[model samples]
Target chain A: MAEIVSLADAVAELVRDGDVVALEGFTHLIPVAAGHEIIRQRRRDLTLVRMTPDIVYDQLIGAGCARKLIFSWGGNPGVGSLHRFRDAVQNGWPEPLEIEEHSHAGMANRYVAGASGLPFAVLRGYTGTDLASVTSTIKQITCPFTGERLAAVPAINADVSIIHAQRADRAGNVQLWGLVGVQKEAVLAAKRSLVTVEEVVDELEPVDGGIVLPSWAVTRVAEVPGGAHPSYAQGYSERDNGYYAEWDPISRDRAEFEKWLERTRTTGVPA
Target chain B: MSTATTELTYTSDEMMSIAAARALSAGQRCFVGIGLPSTAANVARRSHAPDLVLIYESGALGAKPDRLPASIGDGILAETADAVVSVPEVFNYWLQPGRIDVGFLGAAQLDKFGNINTTVIGDDYANPVVRLPGAGGAPEIAASCHEVYVIVRQSKRSFVDRVDFVTSFGHGRGNGDRARLGLPGAGPTLVITDLGVYRPDEHTSELTLTALHPGVTVEQVREATGWQLRVADELARTPAPTSDELAVLRALKEAS
Candidate 1:
């Protein structure tokens, strides 16, 4: 059964040093508050995983919390390059960071395989690309039925998976709508899961195109309103595009990023 | 061709976007990347290709946003979509099965053969000069979509003879490369840039400059390209963007 807890408690209880953690949200509902909490707690050596490692991951990476990153794309969405991520990879400013990259299809399928309790997943990807050369996780396999050659990727079973949702019932049944990207799979694929919701409701009135994660599937739920700030929860608020654009300059310089980090550290729950 | 009659003033970027939009036909299912590709796809839908289906990797299918989306998973995409699916389903069931008609992409760097490198700029992978966002859906989008179209600014920096890394394979060494690699899609049939338009040579599989955008000269295109570019025997001038296209494109930008 899922436990209703505070964001700090959830991070302390679920995330640990050197753990493979996934905070999965595509371009919407990113668990920014939870990422902030993890940073505030000073957790280190985490293998952070996500499809698109946007500003949240950039913050975590810049704060020197991550030891490795497994992701497809790492950018500031509409704005530009993720300066902190670029710094880590190019110069190793905070610390020497390692990266294991994959295409979106491969990463998504890896989560699917992990959720399905499978060893690997197959797809028609990376055939002529150099991604196969760089990443060892991508391999070639022959189909048993058709004798066709295909690419195979190992399942990504994270130690802990975190996500932000629109709402959750008191019993901790989480519901998310609008661009529900890989949150369900990421939760199911992890040994433990944490969901930060905009509110804890008496009941989740069925939302159109909403995905519900049953209490039993999820480990914990924390009510942190506006948890996905900067990145938004569909019905709750709008994506702060200006903030994303503003982040470029702050993150560009090392001293400015450090100051922002300090401010984030000093701030409370909804950092 | 005479440039006497057209009086409207527009940036080369606008012309590039309009030309890229013109490539899409109505009813085509286009897998769109964010930024330049997304802008072009939305422009096409609003103008010439009304029924064009816009698919975002964030799992919004047939997304019809009134304003341009800042990101692939913008709430507008979901709210306006015909159906929203999980990320896995978007790639596995929709894209991997060859259901999408076209894949529109943007590149940080591209080679003469259309190979893309969105990974890194420097020679060393461990220590790169500039670290770019790695491949999102471009590899499979390049492989599985019935055809691929690339939109990137033409420059010596972006248009290289050889990409630092092949983030998405276009044509490896030229003819029969994709076939030999078991890639299914017809990779990068058209490439639109600020300078002009390029189409792959049927026999050589090398991208050849097929048309120039308005007043852009062939010499200018050559200078912008990193490689010794090839030109079509009967190189044509791309028709200037119509008033309707400009109105729609400007409206989209203004709304965004």
Candidate 2:
């Protein structure tokens, strides 16, 4: 039987300094509450890894928690500003960082292959493109049968994996119908696992007659209904599309983050 | 409709022209990209492709985005989307299975053969400058889509004799070679720019302008290109953008 932890307590316990943590949700599907807790806790010198990046990474970088970030796409949603990330990439930041960009499959298959304990996963996605060299951590191989050359990407490993889900049972069976890529991989890759969920069901209540992610992989579950607000999970209200419509007020410039930290609520503004 | 006009009426030709060129068929499954391609795609979705299956590289399928996304990582693409699958399943299942009818793109650099370079702006790989977006699924979409459409602003700097690097895959080594690579389907079928609509000649891979936008001339188009430009004998006039089309597109941008 796993003990239920509060959202803040669960996150603070999982994340540590100098650890690589992968967050769940693509772009903005899931909220960045878990990482936000660490930022509030003022954890420093953290290395981050992701397949694709968005505003949350910018927030993490802005909060001065992230030492390095690894991912493919990096930019503010539409506001065209992310002061935290800009400081690290365009300007120099306190931490040393390296960026590994590749196609979605090139990054993902590598994790799948890694979790399976394979040396490298073959993919035809990155041939002749700069992704092969930029993410040189990924290699190329020749098909013994077809004589075709393909991409061989290495697996991703992290110290802790923090993910937010639409719903979870007390047993930690997870459910997320939309954009749950590598959630399992991030869980398997991390040594310590933590989950942020909307609500806790009694037991085995089928979302669509099935489970999205199971209990064995889930170590911690924190129930926070309406927590993923502003970041829609479908069937929940529509995303706080307006929040992103305007450039995140916090990410406008270098000093903007000072305002960002003040405005954003850790437990979501006492709602 | 009053003739007095309004402040919102854009007098400049550039914004209107960009708007008109991006109008696409509604309800198409577009394998969308970032930057100009994303702009054009969102415009298309707002203007005409309302039911468009806007597939972002992040694996959001049929995304009903309320605003124009600045990048692929916008939550609007996923949270508001109809369905979101794993990174692998989105590409391997939806895209490679031929659900994507059109792949929309733009380029930093191009050659006569239609190859694109979004990787670097300099000459060498190991030590060149201007490391670009580094190809995020553009290659697969370019190689496998039933048809690919490109929208780029014509400029000498962009239309190069040879690409500085390969970002999105197209016309792999010229006519018929992409087919040889078992790339699954026809390569880039259309290159749409502010100047005109260009297609790679069936025999030679040279880009030949077929339709020039109204008020655009062959010389003006050439001035914009980096390569020695060519035009078809019968250059068709691109249709002008209607007021309604411009209205929807501008509103869409405002929302984004």
TM-score of chain A of each: 0.98, 0.88
How many backbone overlaps does candidate 1 show?
A: 0
lDDT of 1 by residue, B89-146 (tens): 9999999999999999999999989899999998888888899999999999999999
What CAPRI grade goes to candidate 2? acceptable
Clashing pairs in 2: none
lDDT of 2 by residue, A33-71 (tens): 666677677888887876656667777777778777666
Assign candidate 1 its CAPRI class.
high
Report chain B TM per candidate.
0.98, 0.88
Give the top-scoring candidate (DockQ): 1
| CA lDDT of each prediction against the hidden true structure | 0.93, 0.68
Tell me each candidate's TM-score. 0.98, 0.80
Across residues B1-256, which tens digit of lDDT does each residue of candidate 2 receive?
5564543444324443454336557767888876667766777776655676788877678887777775565656766777766776777777766778888877778777788876557876534455454455677787667888877777888887778877766776677767666676576778877677888888876788888876778998888887777788888887556677677667767886
